[model samples]
Target: MYVTQASWKSEIFQVTVGFLPDRAQIGALGLVVLAVLASWVVKLRRRLAYRRAVRPGQPVHAARYGQGRGADHLGAYAPQPGPDDTRA
Candidate 1:
């Protein structure tokens, strides 16, 4: 009788831990999502901190191109006001 009971208990344990445990899968997926979300949050925080360290009223041209003559050509794409401007 003791041997029969031990066999039953082993079978039960095996089934409980078998393939496709809903709770275990959910827990594992939740951990993966949490890790990805944490990494994204840290990356965004670093970007915002860098943006803040830049002084306000600093022209984008000065910061990026260092007052080069490229700023002269930067406005070449500016659209001229057309006769249809007042209609909008």
Candidate 2:
């Protein structure tokens, strides 16, 4: 089957124009975006509330503070023993 360039161009234009969103579709998309934004705001508020609830003087768990081996309670890196160091 042989198709001309003009026919292809017309088909492309028709597809593009036909797929253009209507008012209802645009409104629905706007609502979805607003809902997502509202949910994110709610989550942020909840996180802020949690932070406010926590006391500054409260001691945190040692496991929560450390990363790898020999890390201090404050998540700071501590020096590991070398082969030359005789101290056990």
Candidate 3:
């Protein structure tokens, strides 16, 4: 009617281990891992193919930054020009 803490812990451990997966479950887990690896391989192949298709020594088109007047408006630390400022 009254179980000690040690015995109760052992009982819980036995129940937990009893619920562990069998060989079939382990095989299913392996299959899932293989599926994920295959997906990553396919993605890597596509990325490699795209990189190969791009010509070497050609500049990749990307947005140019800090070229416009708004570049100075980024932070409070940036210097703000006044109407009377004459720095050319």
- Over the stretch 20-48, how does candidate 1's per-residue lDDT look in tens digits? 47898577667768998999999999999
The parts of candidate 2 lying over 4 Å away from their true place are 1-21, 57-88
Best model per lDDT: 3
Please give the distance, in angstroms, between residue 68's alpha carbon in candidate 3 and its true position after superposition: 51
* Model 2 Cα lDDT, one tens digit per residue, 1-88: 9975668866775566557678755776577689989999999999999997795887776754435344333344656668996644
Query: By lDDT, highest first, what's the ranking?
Result: 3, 2, 1
Instruction: Please give the distance, in angstroms, between residue 68's alpha carbon in candidate 1 and its true position after superposition.
Output: 38
Kindly provide the TM-score of model 2 when superposed on the true structure, using C-alpha atoms.
0.40
Which pairs in model 2 have colliding backbones? none
Model 1 C-alpha lDDT versus the unseen true structure: 0.68
What is the model-wide C-alpha lDDT for candidate 3? 0.73
**lDDT digits (tens) for residues 1-88 of candidate 3:** 9975668866775566557678755676577689989999999999999997785997776657745455355778767777896642
